[model samples]
Target: MLNSINTNPGALLALQNLNATNTELSTTQGRINTGKKIANAKDNGAIWSMAKMQSASSQSLNAVKDSLQRGQSTIDVALAAGDTVTDLLMKMKEKALAASDTSLNTASLKALKSDFESLRDQIQKAADNATFNGISLANGKTAKLVFLANADGGSFTVNAQTLGLAGLGLSLTATFSTASDAKTMIAKITDALQTATNKLSSLGTSSVGLDTHLTFVGKLQDSLDAGVGNLVDADLAKESAKLQSLQTKQQLGVQALSIANQSPQTILSLFKG
Candidate 1:
């Protein structure tokens, strides 16, 4: 099927070479502009699937980090309130000792009792108000926090147990009327202070444990983020180098196609002979 007019083999070959060069140039340009080997899901289904999984995992890790931060803050508030309550209880104990001394007159003893009552009220107030994000960490309220790890299929829960004055057996309702009664109240207050101290000590330990866990969770989140970044993030330096190389190859490809088309042009000179 060779029925064509003015079909100089040189022109036909030049047109074909030009078309191929243009296609290669367009592809290289697209890659340079997009800065990705597979910019769309259709380009590389497997890579895209893995990238989506990494993205989902990164989001989950961020959520866990937020939860751990809130937990740490709650524990911090509870520990501070516990310290305040402990201090007030110690002051009340001192007042009780003063009231028990008969050397102090009735008026002085009555004032001392009033001061002790005020301190007890303060202790209860602190316990009641120790809260974080509307979640009370003190006053014997229980809460459980959980952390999930996807890779290891591991999880752990942290419980906020009773760390209140009542839990420490510190009864703030005891009455001190007579000097002897005041002495008995002082013993009770002293014992309660010791109990509260021990509980605060325990709370301190628990708070430290929570802090440690939070730190561990934070590190894990960071590592997960890094992993996700590695999966999908672009290497700008490498991409830039590739862009330069591709541009040079595209230029050379065009020149080579021009030379290939001219190979058939040598036949035109034979016709002149």
Candidate 2:
């Protein structure tokens, strides 16, 4: 109520009100521009810290997913090689059976023997070539493929199944020249076929497991992202409305301050009378 030329109480009061409104307007504008209610530690320290931790976890899962995918691809290569070996064994068994027939001529037996030898060699080649990323699971090159499963330092291992000729009990030196030799080979081929088939099935199962875990990791990362968003993301609609209201208040505050600053002129008028 004091109207003094030296100090205007009304102007000081209006300036304080205007500064408060400006602060609120600045905050609202920040939320709208950044689209985050807690953009930094100053905005909301506790919530921002929590969101950062969750975001780190989500980012770490990206590495885990990559590891799992690499493991899956390695297993898939092994499975493909095992399947080829199995097929070759089956074909070799057919050739040996044909050679086992006593009625077959010497030339016919020799032809069948040649075909069997070629098919038998392919099994070794297939196993040796089952490689991915410089690692092989079928030729005794690698014992297992281990991959990260989670952000908590957990892992999964896919044990290797060696499918080499020696590993499968198949002899590369075995001959199929006579009926008795051919019968002997048939037995060995049967056992090798069974072993290769089982190995392939195991690898297939491992591939499926890797794929499932990878999908789960992806979903978990998405959930973490959503959690972070819930903690810090701004509601644009609400912020927009608040921005408009604060802008109006700021305009009104300026006008009020201007009127208060003119109060010294009123004191002069009183003296003029």
Candidate 3:
């Protein structure tokens, strides 16, 4: 090889190799620092795009879970109101029976009537308080609670069962003026009790269904998150090993470049007078 400073092919080749090694080292260091193989679209276009899509899906599923929670709370409030109203109806029924008996005196009948009136009023109060997030499912304020299940326009709708006194056909506002009146109200109260019980059962089932759907959504989100991780998360162990190797190669590249640069000085040795 002729020692000529004007034409240094070895130096050019060594510089090119060093530049390549530096690029590899930079990439490996980025992976180590960020712990992501695809931090941007430039990393791996296809994998980064797929991971972003999965991340969006996971976020949507989380939103669905939140909706399910609100739906469940609304239904639960209605169910609790139905339970209270049902209990009140049972007490009212017993009061009606006691007042209807011929053996009961006028004062006894009046006392039973007063208790029955109070219990009946509580049913309305329970229905009023059953509202959740401004939704009165038990009192006929709304027809249903709709929860989004996914980003694909799917949903879960729970039909509201109005368990109010008017809803149960128990709107006899007049107090028991006589035994006959008390007897007449018993049948209606019995029906209302059964109706309220049925509504509670339905609401409970819907709440359980919502809970189940939330569980399913959580699992779906976990799967999507794992998919995103698989696509973009770096294997630190592998990256660390690569980092060590790149550091070694970077040093070797520097040494080789240094050796190539020194070749031009060798031409001076021929003229060393």
Candidate 4:
């Protein structure tokens, strides 16, 4: 309660409190604007670093997801082509059965032979065109696809199937010249159909496996994003409350400083004579 002309302790104390309140106000306002508690390394070095690392991990997983998608697409194209080839083989089997009846006339036999050859050529064409992203599973063009972006040992492997007619033991020069030839042709076509079916099944399995891996990676990326948010994101509700309280404290600080500044003037009244 002592007042001196040379020193003003009240003013000094009020100024100190005002500066502290201002600092808090500035920090609260920053959070409100940026919506982040740790906007930079200066805010919280340890937490910022951790969030940064997780963000990098999320990016890597995103790349893995992309690769998985591409691999799935490639497998899909191959499966479709294989299914068409299976259908073609079945038709060829019917033609072989018809041709086996040596009682048929020469004209009818030639027609059957032409129809069968056309189907065989179509199977080859289907295999050749079954490509996605410049990748073909049949024709032994590609064997496997791997997707793992991180340096750590984690990846999804998708296997390809060889459903090409040539791969299935279907020879281009194979012809049904006699009833005996027709019997042999039927067996070979059956075997090729079964082989293509097995390859299709394997491709389907690989597709499902890749899908499962992609789903898991999606969830993992989401978790990483949430973790980063927990480390750096601000609670706007909490910041709003602090902002109002600091504003009130600032007003009080100003009033206190005004009162202290007037104390020096009170010394003038004491000198009245």
RMSD of each: 4.1, 1.3, 1.6, 1.5
Per-model TM values vs. the true structure: 0.79, 0.96, 0.94, 0.95
- Write one digit per residue (lDDT tens) for candidate 2, span 54-148: 99999999999989988988888888898888888899999999999999999999999999989988888999998988888889777887889
Query: Which model scores highest in lDDT?
Result: 2
lDDT of 4 by residue, 1-273 (tens): 777988999999999999999999999999999999999999999999999999998877877888888888888899999989999999999999888898988888888888888988888888989999788887677777676633254777777677777778887876686766887899999999899998999889988888887788898899999999999999999999999999999999999999988889989998899
Report the candidate with higher TM-score, 1 versus 2: 2
lDDT of 1: 0.69
Candidate with better lDDT, 1 vs 3: 3
The sequence of per-residue lDDT tens digits that candidate 1 reaches over residues 86-187 is 798779889888888989888998999899888888888898788888876677766554544333435545565454557656666765887888888888
Find the 10 residues in a row with the least total lDDT in model 1. 1-10
lDDT for each residue of candidate 3 in 1-273, tens digit (9 for 90 to 100): 776778899989999999998998898899889999889999989888889988998988877888889998888888888878888999999999888898888899999999999998888889978987888788887888788977675999999898877888876484687999899889888888788888888888888999998898898999999889988999999999998998999899899989998988867778888
Which residue pairs in model 1 clash with each other?
Answer: none
Q: If candidate 1 were superposed on the true structure by all CA atoms, what would the RMSD be?
A: 4.1
In model 4, state the lDDT of residue 121.
Answer: 89
Model 2 TM-score (2 dp): 0.96
> What does the lDDT read for residue 96 in candidate 2?
96
Per-residue lDDT for 122 in model 2?
Answer: 84
Q: Alpha-carbon error at 170 in model 3, in Å?
A: 0.2
lDDT of 1 at 18: 60
